[model samples]
Target: MAAMIGGAKPADAGAIAALNRAAFGGEDEVGIVERLRGDGLVAVELVAEQGGAIIGHILLSWLPTIMDGRAMKALALAQMAVQPGHQKQGIGGGLIAAALDQARAVGAEAVIVLGHPDYYPRFGFSAALAGNLASPFSGEAFMALELVPGALAGRQGSVSYPAAFGL
Candidate 1:
């Protein structure tokens, strides 16, 4: 909560990469972030900064989806990360809250995420909402949240993440 939450600028990519690397203990997520940026798939990017240093990041990318062969675009929340030292300090939650506000402001319909079942629902993501969607990951870990009520109503099909996701 001590950190200032703001939109991530292009110049913060290096610091964001380092933060993701430390948070996830690998470079895969960092690579994903870079690729998303390079491919112009990112819809929203947010950061948590303190002491003039970037300590956390959250990115929402455009996800192309089909429901019964019908196409509509949605947002995907990916690689929400906080520096190891900043874990458990509410930075991740703050970033998510800010990202959701931005996403909603931009008239996004819904957002999907593959994350901890318990951790994400607190932010309105629900496994039941993602039930009919097919993905490479487990259903329990895949979830969705509607920015506007009934956004996902009666929809069922697969999500095609931007090519940058390497899916």
Candidate 2:
């Protein structure tokens, strides 16, 4: 059977961290996940499991965005990774789909990500949509997706991500 994507449990932290390290070839992602969890900033986290082992992971965290003088509730797709051996099998895409769905279900108005210019647009993320929002990371790699239509229609604003991001 294929791997199944589901909400991560507290017990899954160790496995998720390990997978992040393995998939990213470093500890940056692991540390980010830990800090996010420690700071109580994680809004949604999911894992892909098969044969009782986690092979993929994705996380969304609370992001504070102010647009047109009003605060809007948003989420950030902080990190996503799939085990090296599973990279091309669509597991990562599944994790993204599930994460976005969970983000919407939790009432996030929009979600932001700094990722591949070519890869993220397929998921409806658009740099043009994020053009009005200012962040440390900009240009094509930084994109936004609105879970609620017209949620991000604003003249200009800035996003303040949690301290866990170290930005």
TM-score of each: 0.94, 0.97
Quantify all predictions' global Cα lDDT against the true fold.
0.87, 0.91
Show how many residue pairs clash in every candidate, following the order shown. 0, 0
Off by over 4 Å in 1: none
The lDDT leader among the candidates is 2
lDDT of predicted model 2:
0.91
List CA RMSD, all candidates: 1.4, 0.9
Superposed by TM-score, candidate 2 places the C-alpha of residue 85 at a distance from the truth, in angstroms, of 0.6
> Worst ten-residue run, lDDT, model 2?
158-167
**Candidate 1, pairs of clashing residues:** none
Expressed as tens digits, the lDDT of each residue in 35-128 for candidate 1 is: 9999988889999999999998999998887666767567999979988877888989999999999998877888999999989999999999
